[model samples]
Target: MYQPDVFAFPEEGQSGPSLLPPPGVLSLWRVDVARHCGQAARVAPGILDAGELDRAAHLVVDADRECYVASHVALRILLGARLGVAPGAVPLTREPCPSCGGPHGRPATGGGVHFSLSHTRGVALLAFADVPVGVDVELLPKTGVVSEIAGQLHPAESRELAELPEELRPAAFGRVWTRKEAYLKGEGIGLADGLAAEHVGTGPRPGPGPAGWTITDVRVPTGYAAAVAVRAAGQPAARDGDRRR
Candidate 1:
């Protein structure tokens, strides 16, 4: 049972909190987009890079754009503080595609830290670790849709969902979905690898992750589900003295 250092956004009009997770300690930060909506325009311009700003501008829906800007700004602020660089100046790169070698997979930084971001509805989640890491958060689907998409999960997960009482199935299915996604993203591959190919079963706790990876369920606000995955055992954990606010 890995416990992540969790941070929440401060009250309105206050500067965002600084974060410096202990080395080897995975940090999970959650932001409520609605709480930051009023300050998005003022804060986002200062934190987001040019590419991120441009991308946010092209989002057709107002809520989607707000979430995009809030999530990216939070990522930049947190990572920048840790890296000792200005938020907008933090360099973010993508890993080459495993199949085609195209530069369009997981987002990365040159400083050796790994991170992943996920957002839905009005909430965003960011995770940071010393080793490669992926985090995913999803808004629980409606009960009717649970059965509709059950087949997309691994056989074991699907069977488990079938056995669950109807009211409990959506949340159970969400756990499986997020666990699978976090593992895939940590591997630098998105759903392109196929969710059905892996067998992370449905339960309050995560089942075995892909070999060499560790998966853990994340505590999230009601109506949302989240998870994080990191390389099981590899490089030494980052040292506490290495981080600066």
Candidate 2:
């Protein structure tokens, strides 16, 4: 099994949490956006940058806006604490798309810290590393969506899911989805690049990622699945003994 260093943020009125994962180490954090919704209403006014605030404003759904603001604010707070900069002043930008040259790809920064964020329902996940990192979290599939999209996965993954007991396929599909998305996100390309091209296995352990990239499953709350990917020279060893609280 893969284990990542996880962190819990301090209460809203308290000082921001400080996280400093060692170089080459990937740190993953899971935030319950619903728990921080109230704090977002208060802290977002000052903590979020103009761009983030504007984006939050454009979200029509109240929960969506709250999740967006809370996640972005949490990200800024973590990044700012790590870089010793004001959260509101953290310089954030998105790399141009490799296919169309549009500024809509992976979020990036110049401080030598790479990160990726993803959220589904009320939960959000963030990942940080010295090298490119990508993270994805998904709620358990409750409908036919998994089966509908199974064909989009790698051929082997498709077959794996096809053979699983009907009751177990959703979790298996979620695992495969998060693993594939994590790898693609780490590559600086999102789902726009397509999912069928890469084949992360459907088993509990992640399959090989593209060259120079390592993918690992992240333990998350029940009813959800998450994974993280990092660019590395070689595969990362399972942290069975290094699991941290």
Candidate 3:
């Protein structure tokens, strides 16, 4: 695990809601910083701290395990500081599940917090909060893969991407892919759940009711597109596209 640059929470006493949830309501003022790195050396020791990563050795059995350990360590430290708990006592675990698999394969802790993680290249992203959350990022391929995968995305999403100008196809496809992925993650049923058929257009669109999901476009570096999906109660003011930064 690596340390991230921490910042003071905003004076407003409201921390931003991640796309996924139990929606940490304790205090919005806590800032959990993150970084994208190709190797562990890039992480700052001050941010990661020793105690936070004590369990990291136990988590590195595979590539996914490595990513999860690093990501969890980063999140626990940030969230622990926010919640006024000792970073090591924050209780980060592998998210136990004996049967569930596919997109919703996340591990859960006892508290209301829920999270989902995804990584591509060397970057990993963790989405955590009080609601069920799922997040994904993809490094865009300049080929016609997006167009070819049109049938893979929801019908409306496919149409939207098709309508995009030639140069914008990549971006449009990335957006829809991330959104659909995030939605599926929130549902606890990843891509194997047939995304094109279920939850399509079931989002914030009127007459569609609330898809019981929220999506935020994540602004990762160029060539990589990402989105976060969170399930929330009522309609948080920050609904679909609300977290599109």
Stretches > 4 Å off in candidate 1: 1-19, 235-245
Candidate 2's error at 169, in angstroms? 1.0
Error of 1 at 87 (Å): 0.4
**Model 1 whole-model lDDT (C-alpha atoms):** 0.78
lDDT by candidate, in order shown: 0.78, 0.76, 0.52
Cα deviation at 142, candidate 3, in Å, is 2.7
lDDT of 2 by residue, 128-244 (tens): 888778899888895388889988877888899999888898899889899878877876667765677767888888877565677888888889888888877453422223211
Write model 3 residue lDDT over 52-156, tens digit each, in one string: 456544555455445544454446545554455644455544443213533224555556566666666545566666666777777775748866787775567
Candidate 1: tens digits of C-alpha lDDT, residues 102-169:
99878998666789999887888899888888899999988889889998877778899999989999
lDDT-based ranking, best first?
Answer: 1, 2, 3
**lDDT at position 176, candidate 1:** 91
- For all predicted structures, in order, the TM-scores are 0.87, 0.87, 0.59
* Candidate 3: stretches off by over 4 Å: 1-70, 82-104, 198-210, 234-245
215 Cα displacement, candidate 3 (Å): 1.6
Worst 10-residue lDDT window, candidate 2: 236-245
Per-prediction backbone clash count: 1, 0, 17
